[model samples]
Target: MQTSSQLKRLGLFDARVPRYTSYPTAPHFKPGIGAELLPDWIRAIPENEAVSLYVHIPFCRRLCWFCACRTQGTATAEPVAAYLDSLKQELATIKGLLAPGIKIEHLHWGGGTPTLLQPDMITDLTHSILNAVPLADAAQFSVEIDPSEIDEARLDALAAAGMNRASIGVQDFDPMIQEVIGRPQSYEITKQAVDGLRARGINSLNMDILYGLPHQNTARIIDSVEKLISLGPDRVALFGYAHVPWVARRQTLIPTEALPSAEERLGLYYTARDLFLAAGYDEIGIDHFALPSDGLAKAHKAGTMKRNFQGYTEDVSKVMIGVGASSIARYPQGYAQNEPATSKYQAAARDGRLAGAKGHVFTDEDIARGRVIEELLCYFRVDFSKLADELSRPIEYFFTMVDGLELAMPGTTDLSGTVLSIRPEARPVARMIARHFDDYEMNESGHSQAV
Candidate 1:
């Protein structure tokens, strides 16, 4: 690994960069690419193609202070039921635009807590989704489950609906850290949820844990990672906590003084990373780890892993349709996002109109640069010869883009012939290195720490 002084000189300690889940991140999406253009994007998909679908449930029983996702707290089921109706309506509207024989290869239900849905709601939503577009053979359906909010009935409903994968959020096992983050979930409850899922034969489990939190230390993270490993997750996402109080107002509740410095944050990540490696987990991308038998590890080995809004994925579908308030969809043409406000999204959906509110249309340059960025992030290297051939461009086209990359971060990169690789020691600054190819100007405050 690069020494602290060398890394600091390269701006690893004080740089803010995008996770690059998308080519031009969400902030770059603008208005005017809304409801009117969304239908065309949907209709353009070829008949009989398999695609991915993402459903957003933006309601939570209690909002965690560390989350920046668009969500609201609701004490009653009335709002949730109404939102369910909107989702069904939106799905039906999309069905009208889809060509014949289209099937969903991947279906993911994400935050605020998809498990918040009652048993009947879960079944109803699943049925509605299938009615619109059936699941493809061997389709993978996953849901983000909150341990504090799940039970047997919900699990039974999910299993009955063909959910084969489950992702649980275990931010940290330490009680003090949980309290400071306002997400009070106990390890016992988490284990119970995991056990229930395994009991129902949903063994493909994914767990997410945060590294940088208020008052987090190497010892605390070590304990948390050990407890997480005890649960036997198939995959784990070790994310660095992004504290953007200016954007996520609830983050203001956290004590800024208690947060770790950039250097300490890096140490926390490496500590957890070493533990996962010691436990026989193969590192996936920059922040994920998976057991040898897991699909992610297989994808990594086979060079088929991809990064999307949900982070690293093995799904290779060219189209991903997002349904619900604040959801974003990716099409071959570009990206489209739904109305962020629930009220507005619900009104549009009920009226049988697409709820798209903002997005970006991909330019030729956008697609080329996007591929370079994605390849570098996923493999820590870019195969210029292959990209040039795939993109129908000359090799010199890519060579020009790397003109100053190595000079900017000396001794961290190697450009030999047609490939550019980031040195293993400099992988910690991979995001910053990838930024060398980003053509869009950024608002530093909009991103998280580079480390």
Candidate 2:
């Protein structure tokens, strides 16, 4: 394996760009598309097709300094209780828009820490969701948990409420790194959390890890990985630390000088990727990995893996409905984000509103480019010919776009037949390739590192 410095010397990691979690990333979302458009989009969903849902819980017991999510730190239950009330109301509002008796294929809870919600509150929310939108027989209900916030009772309650998957946030187990990030969790506590969840019949598990933190280095990260992998999570999401102190104020607490260099970050990523693969895990997308038997790995093998607001998934729905504050709902037409502030969200729901804040409506061309980007990002190859065939167009028409990318990446871009692929060596430039399809205006206001 090449060292970080060696890769840097070769200029492998240079650019800063969006992760393409969404083609027109969240920053591009303006307040243009709102409540008036939602009903029409919701009504357009095919009655027979099942969709996925993501619920955002924005509260955390302790705010990790390196965290960038839209979350609040709370020491009491009053705010959470109020938030739950708004969430239930939001669910009801969404239910009213969907066709009667809609079937859901997957439900996920993500947050500062979903476990911050009291056990009873978790049950209440789950019941409200099931009551409104009927779940498919094989629907997968999952949640992101903070090991520190959960007890066996809470675990049991979650299982009873139909949660089959649990993702524990274990960014790094190194004591020094944990202290710097302000999210300290012992290996024992995380193991117990997983054991408790499994004991309650919730078997699917994902452990999230982070690299390129303020004090993180190859040795420290490997130590964390070794500890986490021993606990045997079925999946792992290895994310590079996005140091954006400009946006998230708390990030300033991290000593920028201590942060790893760009080249070092690349090495950290490759090192982690090599470690996971050596452990018998198959890389799913850019950052996710799963054991061969895991649904994500199987999805990749079957060429059915999907990328969405929640990162890579097996949920192949064209639409994703987000509930709760800071949630985002994706329709074929566009994406809409709910208000991020808890009080604002609650107030809107209480006023009998959708809490729709700002979002972008995709043009027909935007949708076409989005599909091309999605196919290339998730599968690493896009059959422009096949896509052109679907649109009843000729491949020659898209040759101009290919010419543009070839100019940007030179030898890195390859075209054989009607299929386009980014060379394996240019995998880190995947976002650059995807950007060819992004018709949205590009600016500093809307993106993270391309790597």
Clashes of each: 0, 0
User: How well is each residue in 1-451 modelled by candidate 2, as lDDT tens digits?
Assistant: 4344544543344424567778678888888586768768888887777988888989989999989888888999998998889888988887887886578899999997899877899889889988778789989999998888998778878888989998888888988878887888999998889889877888899989988877778898888888888988899998878887787898888888988888778878888888999999998767899999899999999988878888888988888888888899998889988888888889989987898888889876666677788888887888988878876666776665565565445555678888888777767667666776566643353322221
Best by lDDT: 1
- How displaced is residue 283 in candidate 2, in Å? 1.5
Q: Which of the numbered candidates is closest to the native, going by highest TM-score? A: 1
Q: lDDT of all the models against the reference?
A: 0.91, 0.81
**lDDT tens per residue, model 1, 154-215:** 99999999999999999999999999999999999999999999999999999999987989
Off by over 4 Å in 2: 1-16, 441-451
What local lDDT does model 2 show for residue 222? 86
TM values, all candidates: 0.96, 0.93
Scanning candidate 1 in windows of ten residues, the lowest lDDT window is: 442-451
Positional deviation of 364 in candidate 1, in angstroms? 1.0
Residue 195 displacement (Å), model 2: 0.9
> Distance (Å) between predicted and true CA of 60, model 1?
0.3
